[model samples]
Target: MLNPFSIEGEWFKGNLHLHTTGSDGKVTPQEAITSYAAHGYDFLAITDHRQVTEIDGLDHKGMLMIPGIEMDGGQTDLNGSYHMVAMGAKGPMSYDSGWSAQELIDYGNENAEFVFIAHPYWLSLTLADMIDLEGYIGLEVYNTTCHYGVGRGDSGPHWDDLLARGKRLYGFGVDDAHFGYADAWVGYTMVKAEKCEYDDIIAAMKAGNFYASNGPTISNLQCDGNKMLVECSPCWEIRVVCPLPGRGTTTYRSGHKPPFTEVEFEIREGTDPIRIECIDEVGNKAWSNPMWLSE
Candidate 1:
């Protein structure tokens, strides 16, 4: 059987964070999906803060709505501002002052569910505690609402450092939708699954079989335990870098536009660990941490 990480020529694009009238947004659940689906989105997780968008008659009805919620955490005033994502999950998971944010994260992870450190570099929540949490599955590198909210240079450093440690951390980009005002479809996930379906997409996400982006689109990407292969449209260059252990490194670059001319590189065993990056014409970058085969 084919697995989630196995690329079979299928790609999924959708937003994970969004808000409806249930929270702070203006539109209702139906209107939110209506607008996004028309924009060519394949999937969407309607994450109303502290409130899960109830799909009374709309479960898997029109567009693909992956059930999810944004659990608010952190201290009262300090650096306690944090947001966490519970994807393909149903809850009862609400934000409360009595329970710490980290505790909610633990609950999600312990249940074998998908949890992403929402906008690690945004708002009052930095990449502080998320680094220490072993149960964390992924981190949001680009959050639409907070992309320009706080500033740039939020997730790049943290992701780099984690990659340096040879940790197979996955990166995700989300709209963190508070409504139409935040550009709900701003961020999307690229899956390496066989085709488009609910279970397949969810499985891909859980297996780290995808990459996150705000604008760029990835057509095909593959790695076969040695050389890495990538094909994308509407881009300029392909940059492949492996974040080796001990602060070491390895990198490969190829200049090929659409039609995706080929770019090949070698990775030696004792030459530090590795990762791959895709750089667009405007200098925008999509990165993937090295998938280590050895210690």
Candidate 2:
């Protein structure tokens, strides 16, 4: 596992999924970029539905603008379409409307720097449906629009189902914002890259050198031998999650207790890869990429 915390770089905050008036969003592309840049975002992707939202020669407000598109196809178990977000693609993007999810993933991998399934929980995807699929990097563990709009945003359990079966996929939190309500800046990914340029940010992201969060900041994380160390902003709960059910533990702060900024865990050997979660008092969470012990 290549951990972002173990890498040497400045943290760059960005949202991998978002929409503008180019598709179904309420705001224009410039307005969307302005919102993120005004809020201190270092990079942004305009993932408009089925179409490339061009930022060519447009004012980006000094932010790195990545071209992106969200594709919809492939029937799910719930009789719904599969949604995949792809960014950093080269020229002449085209696809068949009847392409299967796996085919879409193959095309995405062939064209873009990276791709991921979007809102599996919202679409009712399961391990049986996704276990055999290949080429996509990961799925959205948390979506601002899905949570606040439909109460089905958190897909950590879906992610765990894959992890338990040795899938080894990454987790991402994104704001799939259409600007209908309070869904613009709620969830995002923090990438560790040497610079805010396109190559550096995309390289770090494709290498899984990042963390997903809506709130709280993870300052440091390391696993040396069987011992684990985590340093983060004040949090109400800290958890080390292993695929094995009984191997996990939770540390929490009660009423009137001081929030925890750091924690340690002595994981029993042979648990393999484990991920960390930091939850603030209000229930917003930050998720670290998995740390593998078996490697």
Candidate 3:
């Protein structure tokens, strides 16, 4: 089956997880919006902890503002606290620490355009803690705050484990920017949408027409039958990951004098859902959304 990248659209860079002075962030909502807009971000979500900071009246200039919130949920002791980011939320969301993971996920699914688990690796969350939760769109594969603080980011393995179990969760990379100890503009999602409008962007996100990146960018990705082709910014390695035993991953190193900007590989049968990762010499990486063979 062909990958979602074949869809035609304009790619817009956006950060879906952020905090402001409404909570514990160092900057106010206006400052956060202005900074992101000046930095050329197409869209941003000001997801304060437990409270959805209303941005409807704020002048975002040309940048699209998405209503969002971050909440703590699930069994605190067993799961180590489940943090969730809800984008395109309708109204203010109150914090309810007593809700189970599933409960919070369902609520978000019903109320928001998209919902994703945040900083799973930094929280030391296990597969068992998340595998059973339904309605969540995905997990943060890379959280810049987590990486900068405790060096625990990149939940690709955890996401792979869920994919292996037949879960169809997308992956997101975010800064989780608090603008105090954590910085912004480090990680983001490139969403392929019909336009830069709010509805279009939300639609693309819900459809998984996006890729997560810390630095490198994926220009193209195509899958035809058992063959796959990928193109990205010049990188030292391109890896194809399959969630199957014994045939887990294949890496293609760019030994060329100038490095490689593209690579192709043959897909193996039973590798139903496959994803790609491109890593540069400096260790910066980009991730493609998983492609399902049946799609």
Candidate 4:
């Protein structure tokens, strides 16, 4: 059986995209950190717009902080503006309002340990705009701000479109918290890492050792031959999603019965990259990192 979650490590909750008074946020960086830390967030990146706010030597009470920035990649009347979140950034970002999405993503890839497109659904981006951009780890599957502010948040379809095209990318969930509009502790990533350190978190993120979630938690996931197993926090449904059409999706739901904590399914042949999703009664979901079956 190949199990990505079989490793020995603790799951740390983190938010990769957030803003502070450094940009358009309502609160100061200190307040933002305090609020998230109080809510039990293990790590955070203060990804203010076009600026990497240094948190060196600042006391976060034990919360790990990763340097990050959110860069703008021009805009159009129809698609709004393009945004990218760069984590573990080395220094301040060079902002140019004239840069295209590809150029911004390329620059982020060169300067940061982790880079991902932010809120494509909220930006009203089309497949034509995103299919050609490269050098990013992934796009936000859900952004709390977008969901709360305008009701367009889930970009899972956009992500699936990219995956269907054979583009290997991960999915992320972020708060995109400005505090004034969006609250903290809404959406976050659960990362499995060897240690609770900055470098270890970045390494795990790069290796796709994480899952995105608004609620619920995945405890175990495994695949062997034609069998698949999943154990998660009690949920109404557990689903196995494959990229192909005929491969379809295998879903286990409680319906009017008792909720389930785990499920087992027979994986169809030739399902290359498979992912798991656990949806609770309230519709909150936890998404596992995609696993390439060949690996």
State the C-alpha lDDT per candidate.
0.64, 0.87, 0.85, 0.83
Note each model's CA RMSD in angstroms: 3.8, 1.8, 1.8, 2.0
- Residue pair clashes in candidate 3: none
Clashes of 3: 0
lDDT of 4 by residue, 1-295 (tens): 2244978788999999999989999998888898899999999999999899878767886899999999996664485788899889988777786898778877888888878989988888877778877788888988889988898877877787788788888889899999886457888999999887988999888878889998888898877778788899988888787776756464533233437686787777887677888889998888887788787
In candidate 1, where is summed lDDT lowest over 10 consecutive residues?
Answer: 247-256
Ranking by lDDT: 2, 3, 4, 1
Q: After aligning candidate 4 to the native by TM-score, how far in Å is the CA of 135 from where it should be? A: 1.0
Worst 10 residues of 3 by lDDT: 248-257
lDDT of 2 by residue, 57-84 (tens): 7899999998888888888877788899
Kindly state the number of residue pairs that clash in model 1.
Answer: 7
TM-score of each: 0.81, 0.96, 0.95, 0.94
lDDT digits (tens) for residues 59-95 of candidate 3: 8968999999998977744547899998898776765
Scored by TM-score, the top model is 2
Ranking according to TM-score, highest score first: 2, 3, 4, 1
Model 1 segments beyond 4 Å from truth? 1-6, 59-61, 76-78, 110-112, 124-128, 180-182, 222-226, 245-261, 268-273, 293-295
lDDT of 2 at 124: 93
In candidate 2, list every pair of residues with a backbone clash.
Answer: none
TM-score for candidate 4, residues paired by index: 0.94
| Model 4 clash tally, residue pairs | 0
